[model samples]
Target: MSPVEEVLDFLIVGAGISGIGMAVHLTRDCPGKRYAILDRRDQLGGTWDLFRYPGIRSDSDMHTLGFSFAPWKHEKSIADAPAILEYLNSITDEYGLRPNMRFGLKVVSADWDSAAARWTVVTEDKDGKQGRVLTRFLFLGAGYYDYDEPYDANFPGRKDFKGQVIHPQFWPDNLDYQGKKVVVIGSGATAVTIVPAMAKSGAGHVTMLQRTPTWMVSRPAKDRFANTLRKFLPEKVAYAITRAKNIFLQDLTFKRARSAPDKVKDFLEKQLKEHLGPQYNAADFTPPYNPWEQRLCLVPDADFFEAIKAGQASIVTDHIEKFDKTGIQLKSGQHLDADIIVTATGLKLAMAGKIAVAVDGAPVDFSQHYYYRNCMFSNVPNLISVFGYVNASWTLRVDIVGEFVTRLVKQLDAIHAQVAIPVLAKEDEPEAEDIFADFSSGYFQRSKHILPRNAPSLPWRINQEYRKDRLDMRQAPLDDGILQFRRVRETVDA
Candidate 1:
């Protein structure tokens, strides 16, 4: 190792849920892996630290969103950002993950030299200072979202608008909209959450401006069944039961929604009517597309509708023609006056965490390869990327990925191997399938072309099923004949 370079067995990137979970798993499972985690930000919490928008909370239940090793003791299943951040911090502190993590260093590039059987990772810190780390294995556990660049919809006349415009990705502090009219644009979870939160937080009134309706489901903020189970069983046992129950029920609900869209749609709209009142416009709540085609916005305890019933917030289904000096003007000839406008538009999908990868000094293109087992990309030597499901809690898939990676690391060590690469021979390459074909969300559509397309069959299919993935990653054999193992040759000293 050079004065500036440090060598490690594993280099994990992005100190978020996945990275933290990876650290915990490595410490417990692969005891002496000699790993290091690198994060670009000063803090460890990845998305929680990045998104400071009002009413920031989990769309999934906490029982499943929380790490598998850690049972969510709190009753609030749909937790807010601060509570979530605290949970992550607790995990980091408990596992002693802080000492192994070098903060403020963002991975800029990673190059694999076949002869050395190690990756040369180049990173730039917050200070614009460059550093290097050489490691035998590289794990990309960075949160899927691109922190530096937000998805821009290129709203017409955005420059002409006079009122302060804010994006949920980088929400500013001391942003005073108290007792002032607010308009939040977008139909996703962020818009729904902000509309209700701002209303209750003393905004004069808030309107959700949407071009199309999003599927909204009202679920309990607390997990009653899980809490009851915990009362009778031990922590791990109770967590297991709740986790299994929630996963089955959520997956069953998803399958049912996919099979019977009309029934699910009617039930959801009926629920909305019950909360919003008898005269509530079901058309405003009805989405043209089926549920699960795009992820449904989960409104905990119908709080969003409660805000509307209390005359604090409203929903406007109209296309914005342009942003005038005061507010947004609709193409439907209606104008919405606003003191503040929030573009909860969405984020750009970045599969590789924006880090450049090269092999033998040649830049690697992710689009050219297929994702093997939804974790490892084809021909990506000694690398595993953790990108989670769109329909379920991110931690569900992340936890599974962590366990699988640990198994791989141990297997490599057992075989005296320095590198384990996914090699796709001619027969192994299957037909490409557009995995994001059904997802019509703006974010998915924005960068759909850049995402790695998977094969239609096993080992390459992009799985959204949590139980299936758990079985596949946890119980499956590490030697699937697809992974090629290599070891560095010992050179005799002259």
Candidate 2:
């Protein structure tokens, strides 16, 4: 039997970091607002729940990645997947957010009614059952990547390869890879992580084969300053101090890389040479592109390098001509023999799970519209979708966004406003460019076509700076002239 429809003040999508973070804010800041969260996955932690490959961890430090309101008390800033998931669960338990979450519900479509000033959402479950939800506001936290479909790259001769092929997105839970030769293709964060992880997992040989090199660097796993501060000062004070320092350092590094790519690149290579020593190949870490052009792969505590030094794993730079019966054959006439191949290539990006949208029964094409305030869409009422920073910690922007959303919701309620929509002036040009214009990552480039148009200035530009977005999203006025507020009358049958 279909479940009875229930109405809410807000309907949050996905149970990931963004969804959980936003829900906590709404509970504390907007007590009067009622909401429900729906996630397609069966678990509470979205990314952490989905990715179960060995040695999975955050690329950014937890000080910034963790929630702003609730501090991460762990000594390790670079935490493993399990620890991060535990922390998420702990927060959910603390705030009683688990019960409000509905698992195995994939959102299909959401229709906004001008007459009713509410959203009617359609969702389907794992058992092929359908459900409906009504909400005044729709918050999309489903993330950008599609969980069901990883980026499918048809590398030549994939079908004829004798060895088993695996993609990190759909890792087999029980596939025994122990004492077998493994080749992980790709040089991104995923490849770097799995190469060392698989090597430690009893793989006789683990080779990371890449066509091009990606910049990689390492940092200590634990934060001594943050740990010491926690012992003496209050939790909040210590967390704030730690978070601020990390943010400042990260921003300065990125800025310097952008401003002086040659100098930064030389320094990075020097540090890498010191770690790898003597046999260190500069060509393996050095790329044709400048630093900050793509995200620098982070190896915590030099784990990847240690694995290499210990003769557990290796990196090979070459273009793959095809997958042969034995292994991958490179264009340079070199062949890598492997018992298993792991394609950690990349992900397929989709916004809000590509849910069909309509405003008063008229289909809304995201490409035709412009993003307002980096979160809301132009002419889209009571809707906010989070697209975090590429250069800094994702949750930093997420934290600011969560606060902004609840504040906006509260202000609407204060004025008895039924619908709050952002309206871009006709004079405003839809620049048709990305908010992160200079990011040259393959994943970002691949999704550009499907991304929505964006404007270029304040309150609209998707600024990547943590310091600027911190104040802009948190301290900015809610009643900007751009947002049109109204109390639409509900239709009554005579």
Candidate 3:
């Protein structure tokens, strides 16, 4: 057994964007605080590092997605995956964050001991060696996306397929598909990206398989107004304006679309029918669900449409019956010949995987947990977690979370407090009418019971209105709770 180490003030799990963002604020805002960040992976940039599929780019506009303090200096607002990864790496390097980071260390469990006023943390290193450490606070920066394995859809006769079968999340690097026919399954961003990329790379034919059509919109990689502003004014000023504009427009459109469905349907129908042509009616491409039910797809340069127009790619609106030796057999009795199949199914989220936190020695299952301000679990002490939206940039929420924590911690310290936890009752009880987050994903579904069901208020809810979030985040009360204060002498054993 590795010897027990000195207790940490703050112990962060996951060294990805969430982890880095939180740590930066903690270190900078609170001086002389001993904090450590642990990550299972060897490198940083969690999702960005894991996914290496072709033609990957930001679905949300970059201005809203990037860190508010660190304005994105890139000419193109819609950055590719590699570029985003590089940006994350640069932040780590610039901040000298490598020293506090323990790579290849995975936390097995964390139990909160109320009597001792500390958390007992168990971690396994890369070599399966165990180590123990006590920490005052636990901040979960582990993202909502599941990293274990891809969600593989089981079609009949999948084993009989002779060609290469790849999931966009796990594409084999060595395999080349220069002159092969490719069939991409699912209609999400990954599938949309793969089709255009494969077609351009000399794939004889690329087919996009979708069970239902999603709302896809085309926008420039770099907006002219944003570009001009960035060039002339300061990056922060330009970013502020761009972020505000996108947030307002998205909220406005989504609100109008939800309230008045007919207008949205008609507008979207006319746009899709114009591009897809008369053969396939607008109803075929239009979704059965309401607009913004899921995040609308954003395409740069209208590449998906261009690929279809060029006859290199075709859309198959049929449920997959089974996979044959050469290709897939559709439910409509049509079999398309293919040398490769790519499943671009959505992600699976795991909340605080393996890190079990207990209150007063009783195991605390955070699944189906309540989210106070969408950051803290109800009645949970010295712990808070942040998850961003599917619509706007993740960094936007993460930054706000970091700022709030730092300010709250400082406020606690000022009052000679040992523990600082949120008080749900003190902060107005959330009404059923205020529950705002709308995600049908399995992760959200599994844990929604415990999460704060608010209809979307100011800081606690995801308003996506930049002006509102900015005001709330920058000017909200950091200490609204009855923070339990413990004197060191009271806990000391004789």
Candidate 4:
């Protein structure tokens, strides 16, 4: 170890919503601790800054998506990318966190030293310059998806027809699609968002081509209740009430979908009928899986349906045979001629932000280890990875995780402990289950092997229920028997 190297009390990865939220907690609760935030991108907003695709907006309401410490005062609950980014920027300004942020730095790997009770983190810059940071605690808020690559469907004969093939992840700037035919592949949120955007923005015609149907629900862009409350109450109070109401509705809907799928399906069908009217096709809208099995795509203000009704956008369900010079040829003997093709297939999931992790020179395989408290992994000391809920807003989990991590840090100081780890005894090891088995999304299914093990019960599993997790993480004892704390004396060389 270099004598001049500075060791931080906390080193947070990723400058996205999760990382920003974590930073807020550290500033408020552990004010005396030294910490910094780093991200691979040049900008702070992770997903919001990366993708420049049109009609990009939050699927969940801003009341739930915004940080707990901040109040989203915008009229639109389902805000566009710019509004969300502005909100994040405001938080940084209000909390004075900008000085501690380091951009264009990617975490390459992290190795924990038991003797020092600190993590030596390796990082790389945009120019391939290597750097290292020492931190007593490592917090990973980099998110769960692969930032460099999106899931590739690898359509046959891609080089032959291509006018301009694009993935939503890497959207080309100022690409002209006006008065030209556009075909967007996949039926997920990206595709749904892009189809209406392109069609309404001046594409001669847009068609959503999908192999399978995805469950979709539409609500107004603005929240009337939230807006009314804001007029009469303080901004923070109104935000709190709005956030609580949305949380309850979200949880209730998810529970209803699980308990009575048929009823949920019928309700969705009714909503679709109201939105699409004469253009509604039962076969096209109906999905094979139950509602909430995969995330239900949110269509704000029925824009997608409006585009369809106006003869600007359409949906085609079929298998792709291959791509021709003009467009895609469907297995059903139909050809889609297009000037632009958008592949909104899906994202590729990753673990630990693709950072190679090791403990005492032994590499850590996250799949073999069990998740403890949905934040830390078994036997991993002084490290916490923030993974959000699939059914609810991602920020909901972020808030609870931030609170829990802050409390844990304070507890370590109170006990004068150098390291804290969750250790599972051989006799107490629970049956291993797929962490995201309940969600049948393609991304989750594709990356199951790389994820950590989850059990059926709490403290050993990653729970999706935000309400229960919030209570347990905030109220639960940090000195539980499973989590062993130790004091280590630093060894100095003579």
Task: For residues 60-103, write the lDDT of model 1, one tens digit per residue.
Answer: 98889899899887878899999999999998988888899998
Worst 10 residues of 4 by lDDT: 1-10
Leading candidate by lDDT: 4
Residue 265 error, candidate 4, Å: 0.8
In candidate 4, stretches whose alpha carbon ends up further than 4 angstroms from where it belongs are: 1-5, 491-494
Q: Give the per-residue lDDT digits (tens) of candidate 2, residues 152-179.
A: 7789999889999999998889879999
Compared to the true structure, candidate 1 yields what TM-score?
0.97
Stretches > 4 Å off in candidate 1 = 1-3, 426-428, 490-494
Per-residue CA lDDT of model 3 for 1-494, tens digit only, reads 56566488889888888899988898789878888988988988887877788888888877777776667778888889888888788888877788989888888888877767777788998789989878878888888766776565668898999998888777778668888899998887788888998898788889998888877777788878888998789878988888778778776777787789788877877766666564444534677776777777777887887788788988888888889999999999999899999878666656675467787778776542345555776567888787776556777778888887888778767877767665456355554432335544333555455444443454334455444565676786665443344444344221
**Candidate No. with top TM-score:** 4
Over 372-414, each residue of candidate 4 has an lDDT whose tens digit, in order, gives 9989999899899988989999999889989999899889899
Residue-level lDDT for 473 in candidate 2: 78
lDDT (Cα) of model 4: 0.92
Candidate 4 lDDT score at position 223 = 99
RMSD of 1: 2.0
Q: How do the predictions measure up, each by TM-score?
A: 0.97, 0.97, 0.90, 0.98
